[model samples]
Target chain A: MNREIVLSAFDIHRSYGSADASIQVLRGADITIKIGEVVAVTGPSGSGKSTLLHALGLLERPDRGKVLICGENGWALSSRKRAELRNRKIGFVFQFHHLLEEFTLKENVMMPCLIAGESSEEASGKADRLLERVGIIHRASHFPSRVSGGEKQRAAIARAIIMKPDIVLADEPTGNLDADTSAGVEKLIMELAEEGSRSFLLATHSQDLASAVHRRFSLGSGVLREVK
Target chain B: MKQKLLWALARRHVWSDANSTVVRMVSALSIAGVAIGVAALVILQAFMGGFTEAVATGLTAMNPPLHIYLPGGGHMDDFDLGAVQSIASEIPGITRVEGVLEKPAVVSGAPGTVSGAMVRGGNNAGLTIGMDLARELGVTAGDEIRIASTAGVEISGMGRVLVDTIVALAVDSVADFGLEEYNSSLVILPLNTARDIFRAHGELTSLGAFVEKGTDPVEASELLNSALYREYAGGGWPVYMSCIPFLAFHGNLFKALGLERAAMTIVLALITVVALLNLSSALTMIAMEHRRDIGVMRAMGLPPSGVFRISILRGFLLGGSGAVTGLAFSWISIFTINRYFPIKLDGTVYWIDVLPGVFPVTTALVVTLLTILVCLAVSTFPAFSALSRSPSEALRYE
Candidate 1:
């Protein structure tokens, strides 16, 4: 069967450190996720899982590669234009649930819309709706520190989807959660992928969570292979 | 629009977290430093300005505002006194004009009563000696004094020939003029008496014009020149007359004072620079503490310029509040100093009874702008340092 591709990478290579003492993170990694697809990449520690997620999220430039969002080459865009695209078209969830401590959960969720130049009133309404959908509306006014780890992750997921981006990238989204919280977050991610008509790309070490996605890839030794 | 978002975040960072002791302490100390710097600068400047103004006032009082005379001491013979007085009166800021006939003479009291002193006769009817001069000569009011003028007397081997123009006049009350040299050895007599002693009839020495208070001397001189051209230069009087402002008559004294005032202001402004340095250190601390948050902000699509602007706005807010507080301090202190704590100075030395203060709006405005600019400059290093590394690196770490 055929599906519309929302995000794809072709022959991406990334490395760290100077040439004499370099560590190759991704020799040549390629990925594709269709609309409404929940794809997961399972990898062990030091397997370049987070690096691949960062390159896909446009947080860092892959040394030699092409990243296309909705068939548009991201490398061709200027830095400022790339920032704008990230603000409007891409969302991210980190392992630490990087919610700004200065703002409440609702404000943190509304940040994407604010960055997109939406009015505060409009952003507030959208934030409230997303919080309600994620079952964290009760703690909307509470700060990140005041919430539990599971609740903070839920808020992070809400913030990621508030913009209704074409793709959502999660780098070890459940790495810091317990079994029950991780299971709950996994269910939320799949449900949002269906309801929001967006692709979700998750990198994690949990076999159960990886099995829940429509497709699973194992990353190790600087290569990606289907997990059957 | 992006800038608005960043501005909102900056505002949140500035105002939120009241419970954090570190943030509260840093902000309070920064504001206090700026406030104290501003207050010290303004007060020192006002005191310096007041001292200079007081000295200028005293010097101008001793001499009239405008002294009109010809170059090379050319005597005025049968000049147009009416035209001159009318022209001077027509000028703006001109208050009074007087025709003065000056002559040098020797004045001595009764033998064994007082020694002789150098005298220059003034417009007063009788002989009026300065208080200090009277004390030196051991004379008081109602005393007889003899004055002599040696216009053409020949000195012989036997003795100097007295031209016999000696006139005795009763002493009037002694006056105190603020200058030491003038008060010590100078005496005044009627202008007509001076003319008689000098054997000059119907010849005036110079014209003196006094101006209103708070008038700019340069502007007053220009007005005098305009009046002269309009009135006297047509069928012109006997010779050329130069209108010299009293302050210009002793230019070097006030020039030195002006230079000193500028130097002191520059030195006092260094205090504000120290305050700015304090603010910069506090901002650097803030940046270090918020490193993770800044990384998150950059990941949230805040452009580099947006990040840079947030830091600049932070400095502006901090320095702006401090400058206003400082101006308030200056305003209240000036009022209190002028009202309650009047600083007295030695009248003989400073020529004023109490220290004065003037708060010009320009000084406050210029200082406010300068402080904000300084804060911006000092904050640049730390603000840019927040984004010096890759945002991805910041996210990868903590």
Candidate 2:
């Protein structure tokens, strides 16, 4: 509770239609994540968990609310500035490992650093180190199409964290993997959170995964509530 | 710095998995489209330009290089023939100068073939008729001809004196003047005979200056004009003289041809625009196919501007390479067509026996750059539109 807040969403409201036929997705959802903490957001199908996560990640703007990262208000910043902040301060893992099929796994992992204007040599070096840490260094040269789902997810995670962001957002990171693979990914996520000062905000349906986090929340009917 | 990163990313995307069948096929189709457009434009433009040049050359061959005429819209009789001849002879490029007495006359052949002709002084004594005129008059070499100048009837103090002098001369071979109008109305005689018939002693209609082979007629004409102006400045001039370059006589023809070339270039450029549109479509598909990857990049902190640049770079590669290839193909086609496979044309109709092709460097450069710019513009529209969507919108489902 006394830990430093790395990322926080305050009264986020979002909808997905016109005023006459609107489907309210995230109506005043709020959460604060501290450094090195793992917080999980859980909900049933179509329960606006992804909407809340997207708004916090600055991937989409809320109808009315603010997303703050490291004390900077994302809503107040221009889109360009928000993107820069996202690149420098936030990491993202998706339900499906969205590795660029044209690039090799190493290049995919090195993308964030590359996007941040780092030299290829520097980006590649960091990518190699992260790939080895994630135990996927041997598959670095293989393209995404040639990799397994688990390997692809690992590479995505490496890319997400490559910029050394302050917070990481995972939306069903292990959703497409098998039981053993999901367990492996969950272990990796736990290990990454333990070893660094980075905070983790996870939106998942897996109670087992959510139980391992420091705090958990259930989002339903556009409302967020703390759960034991 | 950001551009370097985006460029690197774009380059990788283009080359990576380039061996894919769809990618290879699209790239090939795009390049071929551009090549065909460029080659077609080059050949068509060259043909137009070459035709004009050939017509100019043919006309130049037929007309005297430098013609000195009275500016006051009358015969050259008022010009001091001796002084004009002297100045013409002093001109450096002028190979020779001829004094001609030209008048409208009625010519009758022994076969009873009569034609209205402009009888002009020539170097030979026997009469020379243009080929068309000979054909019309039914006259050939060795035929006796009589010429009468009706223009000689002057209203003098001796009350309507007809200084009608008829000359009898044998017909020589026909001359080819390249123009049907001139060839059909031409009759040539000795200088003394023309002067006696016209009854204007020591009076010449115009002085024609022939330049050396390979000399530019316009430059020679300019030199002659300046010299003539200097003469007028020095003393009393008999009349105002105008030095006309041979090309001036057919100025309207060249002007019409130039206008046609410009209109043709603009029309044919549509082909290149079509090719660029193909390039635009290719980029659009690529942007669509890469939507997920774009989302990933956006998640990593790439701004929409970065996304925009990446899309534009992809278009540039496709369009730039295609244009270059097209231009290269055009150059080769022009050289081959001009060198070994010249298209034949009828000299009577087109004024040249063969169609000529010339590849102007400036035109090629302009066309290629324009195609590239067009490709960029088309690509930019789709890219900005697609990239304008939020990353969440693009990645919503997956």
Candidate 3:
């Protein structure tokens, strides 16, 4: 049976700098994500993998073409509406863990729920449950500065899926971790994706991570092509 | 919900130790600057307000509220004291009206101790001289002083001659009127004696009307003038009667005081503005330092407006803290000075023996609100500058 499409991007184009000195980053990068699908985009450094993830996640507006999250055209919406869409339906996990250092691990995980207007009690409860699921419940009260790299990454994963988004876009999710920690984070991501029928699109350089995903795509010279 | 979220984020940013040492130091300095500015403004305004009140009380206490007289210094030969008293009684604020004959006189006490004085003769018995006049004449309350009125003149055997109407009267009491002009040259005596000395019987220079406390003297004067005109309509009186409020007597002095108050307020407000500029700089530094955190918030779906609100709230927190601290400081300072260490002044020179500090509540409220408004206004530029960068741009380096 075919799963429902959760996120899709068609012929997306993006560039940097002014017109005279602009360098195009993404050109005709197409992607489609279905529920319960763990997909990886494999590329060399500066190959526009992060750019494609940013466009698909609605974090950046594409210069041309369309990005649809749950059938709503994200770029076509107003900036506020696009933010609402991103908050409600899309989650992001960056390579650096990107947890606010001022907050505890549990508070970091509860941030999205709080942003969605959930009460503190409700958000706290959900955050604890997610922390337990990610196998970092013991470190839930620790600040990001005090946590290990692998534990920080687990908290980041918990935060990304706390809102129960249709898709999670991770750019180099475990790029800074050791081999054992990277494998642990990869196992946690795969387990979470399967448990909740959640889709994940990861931009990574690790062939091991790419091979673990259900599908893989290689981006080169501003173009993305699927590798079976 | 959104406001709560914004407040939470702004509050965390303010209390967070994640900021650089330079940023924290700058923030503390900004708060201190605002506190000093607000304290200075409150204390200065309180003291100035107290001084103005003291001056007003001194002037009003020595003089009657309303002075009813004829135009051009013309005396009323047929001045009916009973009729004017009856009319004044009918007015709500007018407590009493007394006929007065005032004239410049040359007074001498002891040998060659002579000075020019304004002799005001009313119904009060005995001769009352100001402290300064008593000192100058070398006379005590019981010493006799000789006076010759400038208005007293007579036709003698020689054509068109001045009359020497010198009469010696013992000083009843020496008093201080709290003003240099009054204390140095004022003398008070009985109406009958003044009439005999000036040789002008049944004549009154003006009708002095006293009003009840808390009554507006100017409005009462206007009401009295209207009533007097209505009573003396159609040539009932020889000339038109006019009422002058006590404030009108020292209009220029009061106007100058008011202008000084306004100028002082503006000059002090500039200090607060300078402090707010420091606050603006501090907020800008915080925004720059927290760029990456702002990007993380944006990635979590916070809009540009949310970022702006967070910055504004941060400014408000800082400004409000400073304002409150300043107000508390001023209150303590004023209370301590007033209660334990009052600043003494020379009564003869400054009128009052002690300089007073009166806290003005309305002024404090206005200053606090304006400071907060300025904080919000100054934070906007930095907030918008933060907004100019996209989330991806902010997160690019991280």
True contacts kept of each: 0.47, 0.76, 0.57
Cα-based lDDT at residue B235, candidate 3: 50
Encode model 1's per-residue lDDT on B1-398: one tens digit a residue. 45677766766665567225786678778888898888888887778787777677667766677888776777765464566677777777888777776666666775754544555545567777877767766678997777777663767997987678787878887877655556666677776777777777777777778788888777888788777766556766543666878778768967887798788788778878888888998777766666667767666676777777878777877787788899889989988998999898865566566888877578877887889788888778877786575668768654
How many angstroms is the interface RMSD of candidate 3?
1.6
TM-score of each: 0.78, 0.77, 0.85
lDDT of 3 by residue, B122-225 (tens): 87778888888899999998999999987777667887778778988889999987666677888988988988888889998888899888899888998888
Superposed model 2: Cα runs more than 4 Å off: A1-3, B11-24, B58-65, B70-82, B85-241
- Best candidate, DockQ: 3
The DockQ figures for the candidates are 0.39, 0.46, 0.53
Flag the better candidate by TM-score, 1 or 3.
3
> After best superposition, candidate 1 residue B380: deviation in angstroms?
3.9
Greater-DockQ candidate between 2 and 3: 3
lDDT, residue B291, model 1: 69
For model 1, the stretches where C-alpha displacement exceeds 4 angstroms are: A1-3, B18-20, B57-63, B69-96, B100-206, B210-216, B219-242, B382-388
